[model samples]
Target: MSLPNDASEDRMQMMTKTERFSKLFDELERCREDEQMQKMEEMNGLIDEMNEEELKSIFTIELFDKIHQIIEEKTLPLENALVLLKHVGYYRELKIIYLESFDYSLLRERMKEMIIDENEKKEEINEKILTDLCECYALLGEDDIFGEVLSIIVPCLLKVALKKDETEEAQKEVEMALLALGNIGYWVEKESYGNEIKEIIKYHQEHQNLTRLAYQSAWEFLIKRFHNYESLEEVFVNDLHFAREARREIEELKRDVDWKRKEETGKEAKELLIFRKWIYNIDNYFTSCKLWNEEVEKLLSSFVQMIREFRDNSKKVSNWCFFSITNAAENRNVKIDDLLKSGAVDAFSEEMKQSTLEDKIVYDCLYFFLNVSRRLNEKKDDEKKEAKRKSIKRKMFEWIEEGYEDVMTSFHAILPDLAEKSKFLQLSKYSSDYLWSL
Candidate 1:
């Protein structure tokens, strides 16, 4: 006798999720070519409905082992497995299962084969498949994995980063590849790939070659590789920013603000804590990079522009921007020549002459001036280096002479603050003296 409808529905609801998912895997294993997309859609539907606990419970070692077997047998498409893996890739437990189980070398070989043909093809789905694989490798990249990805993925990312066209697929390709490179870029061999990496870093500086996310990721890779130092103070200027916002937000919540605005404020505060740290750290790291002249100049241009538009982080941004540039200027053969070539002298002269100057900004500006000024005094300079240095100093004087009175008056306006701060920065005192002489 068949059970009544209510009883049958109750039985279906009572079935264990593992049993249900097991059957779903069975279907995935035998899905026909025409049904693969629909199957993925269905799988996503199921995945969406699963709670965190249920999802976590479902992705066991056994499940990954089964998926691994399917991949080895070519039952499920590699990309499909990757799509499934990505859903739970954030869990450390599951990530290890993937790392240990997948025959990565074979997987890479297969992907390379497909992509070779895929280059000439315009299939978005193929691009998506390649993209998904890249994410999996990026998410799973540990020691050896990071090295492998750095080698194979860097060239592809650079090629896409240089695409002049703005097709959606092309843009997505660039974004994904940039994000991958950011994740695994520490393994990059700076000698072999440094020039191309520089191209990507500077590619979008003058004009927009990358979207905002891609631009941030390109710098992310650069900062990650050169993160050789940390702030002497454990707390950053942004930490204070975060704290003030948090306190203000909490007070607003006590008085009751709109839920959306309150939550957004909280989110912004947290993000500020991290992303802003990244901003100031650029100064710390780039000082060590000394990528030199045009490369360094272009990056500084990009970085300063980003912070120039920062929301509520102005004081720190102003100080950090020049501090980092000043450090970057310290490297061998680096005189920030390209920046001067772009007429930084006139621009800075005008800035210093602003109606009211913050002594702090003036202090920071002094450091940048000090850095470029040192190049003019290098004792052992080759004629090429000396010529380069002299040319920069000549440009500064030209700007100064053109507006000598205004420039001198601007220097006088800050002389008191420079004297006050000189106890801490006697070197900058010398720069002040040098500027006065000019």
Candidate 2:
């Protein structure tokens, strides 16, 4: 009698759990049919109530297939479909299902229909859905599909981004759109869409009401898409403007470097640090590109002068200046004669004498010297090439003559370790051979 009663209680408990699960599914169905946020929230609550084990048991592939079928049938609103997708673990479960059964045409049509439908409801914009759709298309890795989606959505995003009298909510919408476009822009062919995207971003940047976030996103998109100097000329020009400002600030800070070095905790020091970062970023930009014009030459010259003045004050600034010189040398933009004439070689030698010199600084120095050697080797006149090589070798020895032993000791200690890293292996070999010969 006791065993029968216990079995009866166990069956009742199972029935109660099943009943609760059934009610939750019914609520989900209602939410799917009527795209109501409140119902969606309640559904989320129900999903949250279940532990991981219970969730795994209840939200199985069979139910997921049913939701996918509902999405296919177009009976449920997309938002509601997405909500159901989220409940069933959208990224974890749905992504696997879609990727395994990758249907390009079906997904493309659905995306097109959704965008067209959303455009029809202009006042009631659903940018989140659209952004998510862009992300989804990006993940699909279908260039044509991504391009098609971008073509449709970018204009709409631009419209929002360029809207007059934008409220805060509208601004947020524009930001979302720009971010999505940027993400999509990274994968798509730049030639097809870069100009239009740049134009939209330029408008956002020029607008007084727009936030810096939008401008920055647009700026990054432009930089990433267009690699040519002509296309990036505007950014270079902006960098020049900032560089000018920094130069002026650095001049002001130069007067106080002596006072500030002692304390290194005042407004002057702070301002100098900020200016140094600006200079580093500016120099890095020039280093990254093949912008070897007269303007860049002038910039390099200014950097040399800055190095000479600031060498005693800031190691970071000095190191960046050396890096810029090294990069210019490597690119064959700054000739060895000009670099030596600018006192850059002397400055590099001085910096190397410091015990606190980083491995990167040593590498840059070796890279610069290697580039100089290569340039000399490339000369048509053998006599002139040998003469120039001997001159550079003599200059290197002269610079390190005071602490040659110390510099060689440091090199011996660091070179073996640097040789183990593939990037610096060649430099390590050349420097080690050069030092031993010297």
Q: Count the clashes in each prediction.
A: 0, 0
Task: For model 2, state the Cα shift of residue 224 in Å.
Answer: 2.3
TM-score of each: 0.42, 0.48
lDDT of 2 by residue, 96-170 (tens): 222322233354456566766665677796767765554443333323344445666666555656555578887
Pairs with steric clashes in candidate 2:
none
The segments of candidate 2 whose C-alpha lies over 4 angstroms from its true place after superposition are: 1-128, 132-146, 149-160, 163-186, 197-213, 228-288, 294-328, 334-348, 380-413, 422-425, 432-438
lDDT score, candidate 2: 0.54
What's the lDDT for residue 213 in model 1? 49
Error of 1 at 233 (Å): 19
Output the TM-score of candidate 1.
Answer: 0.42
Error of 2 at 90 (Å): 20
